[model samples]
Target: MFGEDSPEFSLRIFGDIGMHGDSKSDHSKANFSFGSLDFVISGSMGERLTFFSESLIEGEHADAIFFDQERAWVAWNEGDSFYLQLGMDNSVISRWNRLYNHGRWLETTITRPFLATFEDQGGVLPMHFQGLEIGGLLAPAAGDLEWVAIIANGRGADIEDRQRVHDDNTSKSFSTSLTFTPSSMEALTFGAAALTDIIPADLNSAVRNGSISEQIYDAYFTWLGEQLEWIGEYAWVIHHDGVSGSNFSHRLIYLQMAMPLDDWTPYTRFDLKVMDQNDPYFVPVDQDLDQWQQLLGVRHELTASSAIKLEIGFGHGQDRDAGGAVSSDDFISAALQISWTF
Candidate 1:
C-alpha cells in the first residue's frame, strides 16, 4: 500500500540499434537511438480512491527530445465490481492498447503492431484522450465478464492532434468494450469495442473545409498457455466527409504469437492495413495506404528487470502522389534493443 504523500514511482528505459534498407534505394541506413524513458507514479489516497500517472520522454532523432504525459487519472473503486476514472487515459479501442501501453519491457517484441501504434507515428486511430471512464467486472454462471465505457474529447482537425487538454468542438466521443473469460477455458479472452467521434475541420485547408464523422468497430482475442501465447485483433474504420458527402471504409488487422522457453522467447507478427485512397480525412495526412508487414523476433532475459531483443521485419506498401500516381514501397529492417525497468 502506498500513501498519498509518498507515491510509488518506477522508471523504464529502452534503447536500440537498427538498420533499414529500402528496396528502391541502393544504400542502407544504420543508426543507434534512444527509444523511450517512461516514468510512472501511483498512490492510494484512501481505501477506495487512488491516483496514477505516467510520463514519457522520447527522441525523434539524436538532437530532438520530447516529453509527453501519456496518462494521469484519479479513480474511485467499489471493489472489483465497479470503478470510475477521470483524467487522461489511453483509448480502450483494442486489446493491445489496453494491455501493453508504454511498457516496452513487458512486450515480447521491440516494435508494436501497426494496429496499436501511436497517433503521432502515423496511426489512423485516436490512441489517447482526456476522458471519463466507467468500468466493472461481473461473474456470470458461464464466465467472468468485464466491461469499459468512455466519454472524451476525441481527435482534432489533424490526425496527430490528440486533444489532450482541450476539445476543438462541443461534440464528445464515446466508446465501449466488453470481454469474457469463460469458466471452462480461463486461458482465453475475447472482446469487441465500438467508438464514434467527430473530427473538426482543418480550417487552413481549402479542400477539406468540413468536419469528418468517424466510427470504428474492433474485435480482438488472446489465448495464453504454458508454452504459447497468441493474440489477434481487427478494426474497421468508417468516415463520412461532410463537405464532399462521401463515405469511406478502411480495415486494419494484426496477428501475433510467441513461444516462451526458459529465459528466451521467440515471437512473430503480421500486420495489414487497407484504406480507401480517396478519403479526404486520410488523404490530407498521407495515411491512406495498402500496407502490410511481417516480423520475427527473439527476446532473451538478461535479468529479472532487463531484457534484450533482436527483430527483423519486411514491409510492403503503396503510395499515392498528388497527381493520383501510384508507387510501391518495399523495405526490410532489423533492430536490436535492450530494455530495463527500475
Candidate 2:
C-alpha cells in the first residue's frame, strides 16, 4: 500500500491480462490475439470515504493499444446502507453489468454477452454513465432489499468515446434499480431496473432538436448455493427517433450456471439478442446486429488470485440488409486464457 503522511489515505495497484484465439468458420484457420491489459487502483480515505479507478491499455487497430478509463469514482458512505458517488461509473443499470468486466480473473468467461458491449462495441444500450449515484439497503426480517438511483449525462455515441464526459443534451437521464434477497433462501436474489434517456443522433445538435428518446427495461437473478451458482438476465429497449419519426425495438437475454468441483469449476451459458432489421442506428454502422450464442467452459484455480480457462462457443448472426461481404452464417470458436491479479 502507498500512502501519504496521513494514515487515512492508502492505495493499492493490481493488473489484469488475457489472451485468446478464434475461428469464424469451421473451415477457416484460427486467429490468435492478445486480449487486454488493465491496471486498477483502489484505496481508502479515513473510514467513510474511498475511491477506485481502472486504467486500461486495450488492443485497438491491429497490434495497437490505447489508454481508456473503465471506472473512476470517489464515494462517501453515510452508513452501511447509504452512500453517494460521483464519477465515471460502470454497470449502473443492470446487475450483470455490475458483476462483470475486463478483469477476466474476476469473472468466469473471456467474452461478454452481446448486450454487455458499449455503444462503440456495437451495443445499442449505454453501459457507461457519467453521473451521480445514491444507493442504500433496506432491512426487514423476511428479506433485505437494495436500491440504487442514478442521475447522469446519459450516453452519447455520435462523437468518439465521451459517454463519461459532460452532457450534450438539454435534459439528463434518470435510472433506478431494486433487488430483493429473501431470508428463507439467502443465496437467491432478484432485481429489476429501468432507465430513460434522450441520446442525440447528431451530438453537435441540441437535445430536443434531433435526439432519440430511449427507454430500457431489465430483470435479473442470481443464486449462489454451497455447490452451485446461477445467473440470468433480460433486457428490452425502445428507441423513438422523433427527428426521423420512427421507432425501433431490441431485446437481449442470457442464462448461465457454474459449479465448483475441488479446485476446478465448469460453466455453461446461453445468450440471444435481436434488433429491428431497419433500425435507424444501423444507418451509420452499415449493418444490423443480431445473434444467438452458446458457450461451455471450465476454469482451474491455480491460486487465490489466478486462473486458467478453456472455453468453446458457437453462434450465428443475421443482417438482411448487410452490405459488402458480410455473411449471415454460423460460426464456432474456442479459447484458452490465463488471468491473474496482484
Candidate 3:
C-alpha cells in the first residue's frame, strides 16, 4: 500500500524458447526470444473517476525493439450499474481479447486463440480502438445481464495500422456486446457481439475504386467449473466491395478446455478459419485461405507470481500463389515460456 498521492505501478516480463518446423521448409529452427516488457500505471481521481494506462516494449532482440501503447483510459462509474470510459482501449467484439488483454502472465497457455490475436500479428480482425466505451449491468430475478457499446475510428488501409490519432474517413465504427449469467449456474456465461465499419479506399488498391463495407458478428460461451474450464466462440465477417458489387463471407471458430490438478493445469484447443479466395479485402493481405490448428499444453505454477508453460501445436493450411494456384502446407511447433509479474 502507498500514500494517497502515490500512484500504483507494476511491471511484467515474458520470455520464451521455441522451435518450429514446416513442410515447405523441411527444417527446424530453435531460438530464445524476449516476448515483452509490460508496464502498467494506474491511479484514481476521487471516488467516481479513475485512470489507467498500459504500455509494452517488445522485440525478438535488443536491436529491433518496438514500443506500443496498448490501453489508456479514464473511467467514471456509478456503482455496479453503469460506467463510461474514454481513450484507447481493446475492442470487445471478442470476449477472449477483452478478458486476457496484454497480460501474458494471466493466461493459461503460451499462445492466444486465432480470433484473439492482434492485427499486427497476422490476425484478420481489428482488436483495438481509440474512442469511447459505455457499459452497464442489469439485475433480473434469475440472473444478471451486462452490456457494452463502443464508438471509434475505423481501421486504416492495412490491417496493422490502428489509426490511433485520426480517421481516414468521415464515418466512425460502432460495436456492441451483451452477456448474461444465470444465478442457477454462476459459472456459466454466454454472449454475442456485432460491429460495423467502412474502410475508405483512398490509398488502398485492394478495394478497387471504392470503399469497403465491413460487418462482424460473434457468439460465445464460457463454463468455469471447480474442476474444468471450457470456452468456445464463433465469428462471421462480411465484406462488401463497393466497386465490384461483390460480397464475401469469412468464418472463424475455436474451442478450448482446461483442467486444473494441484499446481498444474493442462489445456487443449482447436482453432479454424475459412476465407473466400475472391475477396479483394483479404487477397492483398494474404489472408484469403483456409487454416486450422490444434494445440496441447500444460502450465505449472512455480510461485504465486510466476509460472512456466509448455505447448505443442500442429497446423495445416492452403495458400494461394501469384498465379492464382493454391497449395497446401503443414507445420508443427513447440514452445516453453516462463512468465512472471512484480
Predicted structure 2: clash tally:
0
Candidate 2 wrongly placed segments (more than 4 Å)? 1-19, 25-29, 203-209, 319-327
Candidate 3: misplaced stretches above 4 Å? 1-28, 60-63, 202-207, 322-324
Which pairs of residues clash in candidate 1, taking residues 3 or more apart in a chain or in different chains?
none
Instruction: Write the residue-wise lDDT of candidate 1 on 91-133 in tens digits.
Output: 8887898887888888888888878888888788888879999
RMSD (Cα, Å) for all candidates, in order, is 2.6, 3.6, 2.8
Clash totals, every prediction: 0, 0, 0
Clash pairs detected, candidate 2: none
Candidate 2 lands at a TM-score of: 0.89
- Number of the top lDDT candidate: 1
Better of 1 and 3 by TM-score: 1
lDDT by residue (tens digit), candidate 3, 1-342: 544635444444443333333354423345466677787777776567778888887763334778999889999999789999999999988988988787788888888887888887767778999889999999997899999999999787667778889998899999999999999999999999999999777453634657889999999999999799999999999999888899999999999999988889999999999988777666765787888999999999998878889888899988777898889888677778888777
Write model 2 residue lDDT over 1-342, tens digit each, in one string: 545423353333334444454455333355455666777777776677788888877675456777888889999998869999988777556676787656668777766777676555666567777889999999889899999999988767462445676677777888999999999999999999999988766744443357778899999999988699898889988888777688888888989899989889999999898776555555466335678889999999899888888888888876444353444768677877777776
Q: What TM-score, computed on C-alpha atoms, does each candidate reach?
A: 0.93, 0.89, 0.91
Overall lDDT per candidate, in order of appearance = 0.85, 0.75, 0.83
How far out, in Å, is residue 227 in model 3? 0.9
Following a full C-alpha superposition, what root-mean-square deviation does model 2 have from the true structure?
3.6
